[model samples]
Target: MDALVLFAALFVSVAVGFALGRLSRRHLQSQYPKDYALNYYKGLSYLFNEQPDSAIDAFIGSLEVNSDTLETHLALGNMLRRRGEVTKAIKIHQNLLARPGLNTRQQHESQLELARDYIKSGLLDRAEALLLELVKISSAYKQAALEHLIEIYQDENEWDNAISAASQLDGKHYRPKSGLGLKQLQAHFACEQAQEDMAQRNFSKARTHLQEALGFDSDSARASLLFARLEIHQSRFREALDHLHKIPQQDADYLIEALDMICECYEKIGEPKALQKYLRSLLAEYPSNSLVIKIAERLRWLENDYVAADFIAEQLKQRPSIRTLNRLVELHLPHSEGRAKENLQLLKQLVDRVIEEKPSYCCNKCGFTGNSLHWLCPGCKTWGSVRPIRGVAGE
Candidate 1:
């Protein structure tokens, strides 16, 4: 059925060509047998006979694309690419580039289209080279080429190259749709390099990269989070506590991320009681269900189940979350018996399923949801867009 529609569309193309020639055939047919009207008629006949190869040849050979019809070709190539026909789009754009009479601007436009075709074809190296040339040759596509180059560098996991390309967008009039600003994206690239160093256990190098990242964007809570983790790896509990504490100063929305790490730091220093007091102070200031949940768990570990359960129940009354509700069920499951035990079991399973199915992170820019957070949103490729899902169903 789709093939039939495609054939109909092809017939329409030939019909348009025939109509165009009809306006000028009397003057053109006497002078040239290669007249557009005659070629269109021949292509239509081949198509009617179901000889697609011959029909394609007739169509390609007929169109004498010039500056006057440049937009028509560009639009057709763009439509082909949009239809996932990258090879066909490449053919059209390549033909335009090979022409000798195009002006400099038209050549640049063709280069941009061909470069996009190369990108869609997964020819990253070819696309990168062509885009770099386009950046140097024409401001007409500078922003678009730079963005595509950044994407290519990211896909290659070349963090340094990505950072350099992103930095170039600072004053080049390339505005990010997420409003991340070039500086913030560069910071994310630095953080990515730092994460790589951390994975290799190169602590000092990771610290250096993280410091640079913080310098680039001081409001980056992700940088502070990494700094805290590095301190924890070194067993510098005091430093780690300080670093974790700084997350709130940067962005209070991310304070929940540091809760467990903060508790760990305090526990390492033999200060559970102090940790409890600090968390209470934070709860007073922040008013978040995540902080409340952490304090309840700390109480459960230090005091008794009743104390923890009561605290969580009271907090749930004020501000509730799926995470806290799951914890609540667990707190009473061990003590309940008979019908109460069975009821608790069912509730626990239901709540667990709910929490598992729900996404933990969401991209504010594009509304993409995931269980894990990403510094750059996979949907939008915008830095710092994925954030914790907050409210009753989440953090």
Candidate 2:
């Protein structure tokens, strides 16, 4: 943030100085206005000291509205917005817009700056109105205004508007709409729309949106997960199995997330034998501890405690884990007589206490760790960056 303020101050100074120099191109004023020059120096002093808010006030107070100074005010407003001083930025821009000497181009620039100020101040509706006008004008500001319109719509959950603005920026009407940088983002928006449909119990609409999401980005794990949920809702467990299986192929790192739901689908369809075979293949390939613990559970339930305990114990020798060790102790507890049972219980309690403090998921983007999965990392707002932890104490 401090860096941003410094850059903003530098940009404002350069832009103002250039615009005023252009105005003096003909008349060539020999001396600077004493008051204005002194205030400009004060601004430089404050900004250099890392007091950018004070610098913005000094610079803004020094400038007057005129054909020569329109760019200067715009630059000051932009700098204030960058410094996170939205109210002062708005006041400066609004006052500039109200002035009489600005040309059509200068007026549009002022509106654009004010729109950005509203955006910074969380006044989305005001920003939206100004940006829409700029878009309709189709001036040099059209591209920038349309981009901000998309941002406003995204924040307001207006997917249809976002898609429209994104398409325009993508050159869909003019060309193929391929190079605007939002194909993957559009997929997430479609997924968001699918989620909204699912919440309203509109399964058919949800399916349509999910299909659209996949069309936008075939590698979207959230789309696959939501599709699985939709299938599960309609009791199409076998169909759900197909979608859940695709997630690992799309992004292998997210395979751990699909495991539990995959198990449920097979269980729902009365395919425990087939499920075990599938899990075995996955475990052999991935060796994820979740899969290991899952296979041990089936062994304990279908065969005997000793078989399951021995299975986990053998796996632990190769790849030790607190989870597997805890399950191993639980399996041994049922069969052991008094003292052995007591010792196993104590060991289980200790392992439980240790595992309880471990986080389930961690973000590779920002190193944020938490106990539950987040499709969009809370720390960095990055999609698909968080995943289940994998180590001796996790998986």
Candidate 3:
């Protein structure tokens, strides 16, 4: 069917070319017509015959080639560049720019198009030079140039220049501070500085950068988690607990993330039972699948399998998860018999495979999903967007 369509299209193209040739001959032979009609028909014939090579030749050959068609040539080049035909687009724009008698605006537009073609072709050095020059001479193109430079800096991970570009573009009619845009940039910059401090073992400086992140966006779960970890490293168990406690307030979906750390801090402070009681209260309120699993683990340690298994069964009834089901199987594996034990083990394996195959976290903003936590979404570059999945298969 597709081949038939192609053949039909080719036939129609030939018919159109024949009609154009007759029309061109009729229109010309009168005022010498500058041979424009003749070249246009020749170009049409080349296009009809599926010969782009000859078509380009005929089009360029047919040019009455004056200032009037400069914009047309620029538009053609821009179209080719957009279509990923960078080499062809470059030739067209370069030829247009080299022509004499182009007005100021025409020259500026052509230069901008050529610069964009360079960018599309991965010639960043050439693109940057032309764009920087265009930014001064063309007020209309400056904002666009700045935007492109910002993209380049982001791709290169040059946060300082990205920050500068974002700052300059913010708070204007043409451009406003993109909240997610600036926030992500600031967070990454802080994260970068925090890593430097971590390398130097400057815990206090790293803490300061994390604090700076919270100042910019208080809902930064990654920053909060990092601050909690840092406090634990410094043996500030109480402070770590405080930071852990703050996570739910910052973002309730990540409440599960703080559970393990909270228990650790409590154990460090020699208050396991007290922490268990608090978790029991929280489980009553939140009742998350993750919280239930953790609580069941703690229950097994403090009590017996009977109590833990009962707890798991109760929660699984309320909100079933493959993870919760697997844990229940693990609890019963020790006490079960011949065929039942083998079947339970197989079931556990299946459940584990299901959970492992699925991404553990997802970004609500960009829909990026991965097994590991990412403070900044690698897909969308949005800070604090990637979070644990929260349903049957998730936490």
Candidate 4:
């Protein structure tokens, strides 16, 4: 179907070129060169034979690219790029760029399209050179060129370059149709830098990057989580707790990411009672199976298995979950007798398998599922879209 559409578009463009050429030269009593006429008919013959590639090549040979045919050339190149024929797209756009008859705007448009073709062909260095030139000299394409530069930097993991390109995008005028805003993307880039710093044990530099991340976007949950990790690494339990506590407010969907750090922070401070109080509050407010399991374990520790079992049972009435059910069965199995105990053990094993097989995270935008969270969705490339899976099979 798509091949047919391309063929039709190419046929129309060639026919239009023929008509324009005849109309323009009619007053001068001129005729098309024999080779041009032969190639044009050959292109039509190929189209009739459903040989699209050959047809397109023949059409290219037949058409005399000029101001009248520039737009048609661009549209054809764009369609080729969309069809994954990057090499052919590059040839067309490069031909346009090489033409001396094109005005400044046409040249800029051709450069942008050729840069895109380079990027699509995995020729980033070439694309970067052209895009950088456009970004500097062409006001009309600066924003678009910077966006492509950012994409290149991101793919290469050059966080600083990505940050610089993102900063150049006008926040007021450049609202993307999807994904994070510029500031949020900058924040994630900073967080990525901070993560690298922390991995190298450069806590001071990591802290600086985390601060810069927060300055870019104060509501960055990933930054908060990174800050908590930094503080916890340095044994600053109170500071870590402060950052971990900010995550739920920034984005409740990421609260699960902070839970383990929050627990460790409380334990490092020797405040088991405070941890229980906090877990209880989280249960009341967030109401997730993870929080439920945490509170249940605390209850079992502070009181007994019966108390934990009752709490899980009560919570399951409101939010049915396989994980919570598995925990509930575990809590009750030890005290059961004979046949009942055997049945409870079997039930627990079955529920455990079910929980283990379920995905822990899901992308809200594209429905990608995995056992671990991804800040950038693998399926859609949308930042912060993959989060903890919610409801019956998960948290």
Candidate 5:
């Protein structure tokens, strides 16, 4: 839908350009207006025929460089950029920026276009300098420049600079419902700092950064999970449990993330019974297939294979899963030998293969899936969107 709208807008702009060119060249003698209109039709024909690169060249050639046609030039250059002709776009935009009679706003707009062309051409330093200038100009486009600066900083992994740029943007000037904004961006910066601390084994420092992340946005589930993991590593089981519990309140979709970790903390503190009780209560409420399988593992350890088998069978009837089936097969493997046991072992191997192929975490924002958690999404550079995948082949 978005693509269709953008294409429609581009088509309308080309139509407007054609009209302007025809009307302006009407004052010229004889074959001039006829040639211009013919070229315009040819460009439109090429664009509609999907020869967009050739069409761009035709359109650029058809537009004459007068004050009346400067807007059309700018539009054509932007279209070239959109079409991925960065060199052509840069040449056109740079030419406009060098023009002497351009007004202050027109010059700034051209500068912005030139910066965007540099970005598309992977000229990061030039783009960054131009964007910083745009930021100081305090136009409505300042927000856009700030956004581009954030993008540049993220590409460079300059978390502190990214946070500063994100903070400088006026959030109210943007579309209200978009998730990417000041608070989310700031929390991401803190999360990145927390990850660096975690890498250095500075658990206390990591905890402090995570606390700041939560202070920036209490609904940051990634921060909560990080804090919980840090506490667990420090043997503060009770504190870890508190942090784990906060995920449900922050985002119910992430409740499963804390379950296995919280259970591990429970066992480490010598309270398996409490963990069992909590699992039963969680099953009564959320009733996830992963939680069910985990609870069945606990049952097998406490009771026997029979009890675990029965529990898994009951849960599979309610929520069918390949993981539950594989677990059930393993329970029956111990009592049997010969061909039956060999076949069961093969089936387990197949299940293991499937599970191993599946990504452990996925980014909700960008659909980037991977084996490990990333506080910042590698694909879209958004924070706290990558979450543990839960189902048959996941946590």
Candidate 6:
């Protein structure tokens, strides 16, 4: 089916070329070029012989690019690029740009296509130069050029440039179809920069970047997480708790990422009771396997194994989970004797294997599963989409 579509598109382009040549012949008082007619037949013969490359070359040779055939040429180049023939696409678009009679729009369009070819071929530096030029001189292509520039910067890990391009693209009127608005994209970029600063132990610089990230997107969970890390690094436990507490409100899907940090902050402040209160609050609002386990561990530490086991059993009635069940068995295993003890031991081992085999995190957008959380989903590259998996077998 794809081959047929390619053939049909090529045939239409050739037909259009033939029609244009006929029209030119009538106006110029000259016979239509015999070479054009011969090449058209040669292209058809190549197509019939299953020599698509030769067919494409012959079709391109037959077409005389002018105002009339410029769009056809551009369309052919774009099709070739999409077909993974980047080198041929580059030649076609380059040939168009080299023509002297092209108007500004045509020139910009050709430059944009050639830049795309460069990007596809991994020549990002060349693509960046052409896209930057287009962003400066071509109002029609400015947004498109900036979008491509952002992609290049992201691929190159140049987050500052990505943020700058995203800022230019984030007009009041613009909204992306991915539902990941430019403001959110900019926020992620800023968070990326903050991460770099934090790695270098530049706490002040990291804080400034996190502040800018939150300014771009007040609901950025990644920014909150980073801020918590920065504050904790400085031994500002209270400040860290403040940032960690904001995560559930900013994006509850990422609340798991802040849970350990919240516990550490409360511990550092010498407030186990406060930690217990906060965990209960979170469990009441957003119950999950992790919260259940955390609360049960606290119960065991403060009271007895019986209390933790009973708590897990009651919670299991409300929300059945393998993780809670496993914990329940572990709490009771020591108290059992003979067959009962052996049975609980076997059950625990089985549940442990099952839990280990299950993925802990999953991408909400693409269903990519892994054991670790990814702020940007590896499958879809969507920011904040990957989260701790929830349900019977996960947290």
State the lDDT of candidate 2 residue by residue for 1-395, as single tens digits: 76665646564664566457546753645554667656767877776777766776667656656777776677767866887878988988988888787788888989999999999999999999999999988577888898788778867879878778876674443222223236666787788899999899999999999999899888887889889989998999988998988887787667777887888999999989999999898887788788888999898888988889899989999998999888888888878989888898899999999999998889887899999887657786565678889898888
As a whole number from 0 to 100, the lDDT of residue 225 in candidate 4 is: 97
What would the per-residue lDDT of candidate 3 be over residues 7-84, giving only the tens digit for each residue? 344334434443454455576646645555566668667666766656655565455335555645665666667667
Query: Of 2 and 3, which scores higher on TM-score?
Result: 2
Q: What lDDT is reached at residue 154 by model 4?
A: 78
Clashing residue pairs for model 5: none
lDDT of 1 by residue, 281-345 (tens): 88888778788888888888889999999999999998878889888889999999999999999
Model 1 alpha-carbon drift over 4 Å, by segment: 1-35, 42-58, 170-172, 270-274
Go through the candidates in order and give the clash count of each.
0, 0, 0, 0, 0, 0
Compute the lDDT of residue 251 as modeled in candidate 5: 74
lDDT of each candidate versus the true structure: 0.82, 0.80, 0.75, 0.88, 0.79, 0.88
Give candidates' CA RMSD values in order.
3.1, 4.8, 5.7, 2.0, 5.0, 2.2
Cα lDDT tens digits for candidate 4, 180-245: 788898999999999999889999999999999999999999999999999988899999999998
The sequence of per-residue lDDT tens digits that candidate 5 reaches over residues 125-169 is 999999999899848579888888887887887878887887787
**How much is the lDDT of residue 178 in candidate 3?**
31
Candidate 1 structure lDDT: 0.82
Q: What is the C-alpha lDDT profile of model 6 across 318-371, one tens digit per residue? A: 999998999999999889999999999999999999999999998878999999
Best prediction by TM-score: 4
lDDT of 1 at 167: 68
List TM-score per model, in order.
Answer: 0.87, 0.79, 0.74, 0.94, 0.81, 0.92
Question: Cα miss at 270, model 5 (Å)?
Answer: 2.1
Given candidate 3, what's the lDDT at residue 351? 89
Output the lDDT of residue 258, model 2.
Answer: 81
Q: RMSD of candidate 5 to the true fold?
A: 5.0
lDDT score of residue 1 within candidate 2: 78
